[model samples]
Target: MKEKEILINWMEEGMTSIPNVLLKNYRRLQLNETEMMVLLHIYSFSQKGISFPSFEDLSGLMTISSSDCAACVKKMIQKQVITIEQGEQTGYEFYSLTPLWNKIAALFESDARGESLQQAMTEEKDLYSLFEEEFGRPLSAIECETLALWIDQDQHDPAVIKAALREAVLSMKLNFRYIDRILFEWKKQGIKTVEQAREQGRKFRKPANTEQVSRSENAVPFYNWLEQ
Candidate 1:
């Protein structure tokens, strides 16, 4: 036979479409090689309009015995990976892969959430290191708890917290009480970004009624959040 004729014959033999996710994650789904092959055969048969192929039919295409094929199908049903339902109109039993697809989708969502949590933990660790470096001392347990509360309870952005720390340092306060006050004030004012914090500081530092507060020539102007 010519190559073209062979190719045409192969094309006419038809193809089976399987989800890439199913192929990649079959092992994770707890399907062994034989079981996976059985599922593939069932799917192929279904594509050809065989909704429920018998154990003999399944065994014919596989190296396993008919009894083994039946056992595998029973195990899959027990695992809730596949289900058999009777058609209402036709009254014929058919296999449904909805449970398997749902399991795969749930696994993907769980993996995404796990990745997000891991990223959040890494960012929190870096933020803690930055705080320790700026303070020139390790954070006390209470200080650590306070920082966690800011991120978890108050939902303060890490960048905004860093900006508040900068404000405290500029004022020569360099204390948690001062920094906490700055954060509280910012939150009350609905300030959520570094630019908004800077703008707030500028507005507060602007001289009122042409009366400037006296300070040393080298002193950097900083918002005294305690007085506010």
Candidate 2:
């Protein structure tokens, strides 16, 4: 293959990665904001032909457990956002995205109602500033509100929200939406104090089964989603 052809071939894995400063806008279903964002990040990383990151790699990079990553991958497979297939040549798993939404929906689909998510976002005027200050990037307005709804549950303290954001940025390697999910998790874990969070992190980091821990780490998210 010529250089250009080689580059093209490497990238033509039929892997459809949605790109942008606002890739999470494409997310849907009952997924928590973090799971949705994590799916996008994983898909984007795989689009570069990186293959799947090892469990340790994913855990460290995503600031979540390997099992949580695996569970999210399973849900992504269920959603048909991505599909995993055993590789014919390498005897490993390969993955691909199905709907070519950007080209298809972006061209043919129009919301004549003028009352879609996009419009709602446009109306939430201060959303971008609030999101960018927390996440280091602008969030379309409705996403900001969705995040706000999560973070504001039970307690609506701006200080709490800001502190959660700071901790997530430092420890989570998180995209904007994940701050909400982590806060939710923290709340459920009774992690109201810095000492509690430190203890929880240490407990989770203890060495465990290499196989099971890397496959389906969290059931709480699924249960919580189901209850919600």
User: Residue by residue across 36-149, what tens digits does model 1's lDDT show?
Assistant: 999999999889899999999999998889999999999889888899999999999999988999999988999999998998898889889989999999999999999999
lDDT of each: 0.89, 0.57
Which parts of model 1 have CA positions greater than 4 angstroms off? 1-6, 193-219
Model 1 local distance difference test score: 0.89
Lowest lDDT 10-residue stretch of candidate 1: 209-218
Model 2: how far residue 28 lies from native, Å: 3.3
Q: Pick the candidate with the highest lDDT.
A: 1
- TM-score of predicted model 1? 0.83
lDDT of 2 by residue, 86-190 (tens): 778889976555442443354334443455556645533344465576656667778666665753455534444454555555454455446566567777877
TM-score of each: 0.83, 0.34
